[model samples]
Structures are given as C-alpha cells and as structure tokens.
Target: MLKSGFGPKALLSFACLMAPLSALAQDATSSSPATNEVIGLRANLSPADVRGPLNYEPTKGPLESFFPDCSVDKQMASELSEAFGEALISFDPENKEVRFGVAYKGLSGNAIMAHFHDGAPGVNGPVLQTICGHPPPTSAIGVSATAVMGDKCPVGNHGVLSGTWQLTDHDCPEGSDKSCISRTVDEQVQLLACGNLYVNIHTCLNQPGEVAGQITPVNWIGKEQNCNALPPKSSQ
Candidate 1:
C-alpha cells in the first residue's frame, strides 16, 4: 500500500524543528575552551598539625620541596589533627619542573618522616619522596638533619630535613626490609617535575604512615611568589 498525500510540506517543517537543536549543541561545545589535564602531586597534612610539640608552632615561610620555580609562603604545621594544610603548585614545561607555594599552621610534635606519594590527586596512591628520614644518628635530632643515607649517616633519628624536596617513584614507601622497592631519587624528581607525584609530611607517633592528602596544581598569578598568590578557588 502506498500513501503520499502529506507531501513535501510536512518534511520541510520537521527539518526546521531539528535545525535549532543541532546548532545549539555545536555552539555549547565550541564556546568553552578545554583545559589540559595536569599531572602532579600535593599533600594536606591536617592530622599532623595538632600533633606536634605544644610550643613548636608552624611559621609562615617559603617552601621549596613542592616545586623549584615556586615559593611556598603559607606552609603551616600542626599536631592535633591530620589536616595540617596544603601546598599549591604550577608546572613549568620550559624548565621541566614544578613551581609551588605552601602555608601551614598548628604544629604540636616533632617532625617525622615526610615524603611524596604517587597517585591520582585525591586518591591514596604510593610513596614518592623522603622529605624526612632516619640516618646516621638514629636519635630524633640526628635523623632530622639533612644527611644523605649511608653507613656513616646511617638512617637514624639525629638528622636534618630540607624543605626543598624532589620526589621519585622509587623513593616512596621507603626501601623495604629487603630492598628499596621504588625508583631512584633522580627518577622521582623527574616524575615530580613532570607532575606525577604529591608531597606529604608525617609525624613520629604514626611511624609507617599517618594522615595524607593529594597535591593539586593551579595557574600562577602573583608577584610575591608564595602560596598566597594562588587563586582563592585553588585552595581546598
């Protein structure tokens, strides 16, 4: 059976109705510029803020570990809760490094092992750096010093830690009882430089690990070159 009385007029009306919806969809997608997906590391040591020494409060200063190009001015410390604070970072494709800044508050205890962890932001991944470690003088003070791991320095308590940190995939989880499982320091730094890891600070009470958070990157927009320069929305 062939029926054709409706004719071309009906088809013309249907085409017109569909045209606006298609054009609107195309315009929406075209209007917004897509942002590149950035890969990097960050940490929010909230729990550590309220757990440090009662008198040893965190001071605002320039942080270097998160990035070589950026200065951390808002780095905070605490020992009461696991939410110590956060760091803001930016990637420098030219120099193959990350620029960052931080501010911390509320420190209550002795600084323990701080390092970088590798994982997608906001997710619990793996270790990446040894910001603080035990070598040589195993005492609390000795290990806190900035000493390299060796027979003389031997992982100990008496040591120093440097705020300027570069993380690697191998430096993470800290060499096991058998052997270091992750990558090398250089590799970790390269990873961090390429935005593949985050920074985290730990305390003595929680030896193996403590509270942790993911590092996030934001666009640079300040002359002071500190965490304060970060956009207000960048902060968590």
Candidate 2:
C-alpha cells in the first residue's frame, strides 16, 4: 500500500520501533547527504497564523465549523482520527505550492479513493487530482475498480457522489481510470503553490464526495476563528 491507514495505537507502536531521534541525529552528522535527509511528520503553519491552541478549520459547506482537538500532532503517526487536522506544507516559496494532507478514519466503509480538490479552504470546488485509489473490496460496499488522478473514470461512474459537481481540468476521463503513483516529496512541494488546495478522503458510501472535513492550510500552528459559519449543506 502506498499509504497505510493507521490509528493512534499503530502510531505509538511505530514510534517505539524506531530509535530515538537524537541518537539518529548523531549518527547522521557523520553520514553523506544521501543517507541523512530530514524526515518526519510536519505542517507548514507559521508562528502567528494560528490563534488559540492548535485547531482545524473546515471551510466548505456543513463542515465549516468542524474543529479537531488541539492535542493531535505529528506524534500521532499521520492523522489517525475522525476530526479535521493541519500539517506544515513545506514547499518552494517561489511556486506557492505545497502538499497538504487530511486523514480520516471511521468513515462508513473502506476509503476507496481520495483527492486534492481545487477550491479555497472553506468554499466548494472540484476534484483536481486523485490522491489515493484503492482496489475494490470483495465485501458489500467494498470498492471494485478505482480511478486515479489523470486517468479515465470507471466504466459506469463519473463521480461516486454528486452535488455542485464542480470539476477541474484534471478529473478522470469519461470512464476507465488508471492507477496513480503516490505523490513524490518534490511533487508535494509543487502541489502547494496555490496555497488553496485541500485534501479530501472519499469512501465507498460517499463515492462522489468527501465523508470528512475539507483539508486546508492553517498558516500557523494555533487555532483561528471557527468555521461553523459556512452555508448549509449542498443538495446533489
């Protein structure tokens, strides 16, 4: 799997398996650059962008006011919760691009696909790129065919769900989507240029739309005004 869906326990277990970072740092000081690139979970928030404690803002539709507890952090092994979260999107300052990720667990079913839709943080938008496309599950509601970014849509569905049906230049073809290569680290930097891209997870139950909060840039590490003021949910 390109990315594993893990929870807090998995995060803790992985943390325990790795040597202390400090010890690793000492070992790296003597190694070549190829053996010592910086690595770990991080967000691109600035020192002042956040206000109160760390907070999440879901700006689009019914999710506007949704907020994740401030306690969630890189310590939790990728986002392993059902709430909205933030990450420091480090990218080329010149390009204004960065890759931001939002993870959600406990959706009605397995996450069959995910995307980085093109829209402002709080506003509605279209799917611009496919982030993850899992193979169909054998069980009921289990996904069968998955479409990746820049590929053709499956034989029968243009979208798993529908509403405004906002679409972008990169949506899959009418049908017959293809496998997607996970985004590369450098590509992550390129994807963040607009400072408006958000990460969304899609499950089999809500095929055409997101089942959780919309991913947005936090600018910093602290909380901001709540997003509970957006419009009512849209009807597809």
Candidate 3:
C-alpha cells in the first residue's frame, strides 16, 4: 500500500544515490592540504625567510649535566661547575633541510666547537654533523649560534647561519664511518622526534663536550608570531 513513487525499490535507489554525496562531503571536511603540505620557498628566498602561513614545525631540547663525570669525556671534565643551554631545531622534510638555534651559558672556558651528535641521553655517540663555531675558541658562556639551510658555515650568533648539510654528507667524528651516524635526513628527523639527537658544545677546558642537550619535538610557532613581539598595547 505504498505510493507509486515511494516503493521499497525506489527508496533503495535513492539511498544509493545519496551515499556517494555523503562520502564526498565527509572527504571535503576531513582533508586539509595546508596542514600536510611542506612549506615552499620563493626564488632566492632563504629557508628562514620563508615564513609561515606555511606549515612550520619546531623542536626543542635542554642542555645540561655535560661533564667528564657524565657520559662525555671524563679526562677533560672541568671543575667550573655544570654548563647548560637549550636547542631549537626546525626541519623541512620536503627539502631535506634543517635549521637550528642554540643558546648556552655557564661553560668553564671559551667555546670552541659545537656539533650535532647522534646519541641517546646519557650515552656517548659519534658526531653526525658539525655546527658552526668550529676550530674551537669561538665564544665563551652565553653563546648563541644559528644554522640555516645553504650557508658555508652552519653556525652563527644572533642571526641565521647560511649553510646546509645533506643527509648523505659524510661528516662524522674523526674516526667514525657512515654506519656510526644517522645515514639519512629522515633518520635524523626520527631521532629528533624521539630525542635521540643532541647538541654538544665543546670548550677550551673540555675539548670533548662541556654541555649537551637532547633534541625533542616541540610545539610549532607560527612564522608571523614574533618571539619578541611586545604585548599588545595594554588596552587601558
């Protein structure tokens, strides 16, 4: 006793017709390319200059307990108390590039070398990458160095260092081989994500490592978010 236009077969056909439309709507709501897309670069623009509105991710870690008595170099451990610092790293997986900023203080002597090492917390490992400020005797406590994606030296202070290193770069510790280091950018990224990579700053006193920090993934700051931005004018 159903209407001619609304029989069971007609209802079944109508439901079938609407299934794809419902799925299409759900797909549209769930997909967000902006979040997944890697940050792109404009011609002649440096990675640091390619601000967000683009996908930007940041990772950070702490540097502390770096002493000869710890896991680094006991022979060169200094009596100047413990040194400490923090490391901020950004990676562009699409371009196979990395950017880093490190700030440290309370070293026993002049800063000589700073490097990114492949190791776990409290475990000694090989140097995977050399950051700028090499050849030692760079700066003392309160040191800051930055590294960009294409400069000659990957380390600087108060500014971006203009260099890059590939995942395949054979820049390991003096006696180590590729097998001793993170062999690929993705591998390094995974290490960073899991807090396996660390920053080691060498000092004149402790030629090996005066201080170290394990790199850990952190919340991303928007490209336009001014780290130093003054608080919005007090709307008194």
Ranking by TM-score: 3, 1, 2
Q: If scored against the real structure, what TM-score would every candidate get?
A: 0.39, 0.35, 0.46
Kindly list the per-residue Cα lDDT of model 1 for residues 15-54, writing each as its tens digit: 4323432343233332211232223333454543222221
TM-score of 2: 0.35
Model 1 Cα displacement at 84 (Å)?
A: 2.4
Q: lDDT by residue for model 2 over 118-184, one digit each (tens)? A: 3443443444554555322221111213233312222111122110111222323343222212233
lDDT of 3 by residue, 65-162 (tens): 22212233333445763555544444455555554445454555544456676665555555566664433221212211232221122221112222
- After the best TM-score superposition of candidate 2, give how far the Cα of residue 183 lies from its true spot, in angstroms: 18
What candidate 3 gets wrong by more than 4 Å, as runs, is 1-78, 133-166, 169-179, 219-236
Candidate models: Cα lDDT each: 0.33, 0.31, 0.40
Better of 2 and 3 by lDDT: 3
The C-alpha RMSD in Å for every predicted model, in order, reads: 22.9, 15.2, 23.9
The local lDDT score (0 to 100) that residue 216 gets in candidate 1 is 37
Ranking by lDDT: 3, 1, 2
Q: How many times do residue backbones clash in model 1?
A: 76
Question: Candidate 3: deviation at residue 141, Å?
Answer: 25
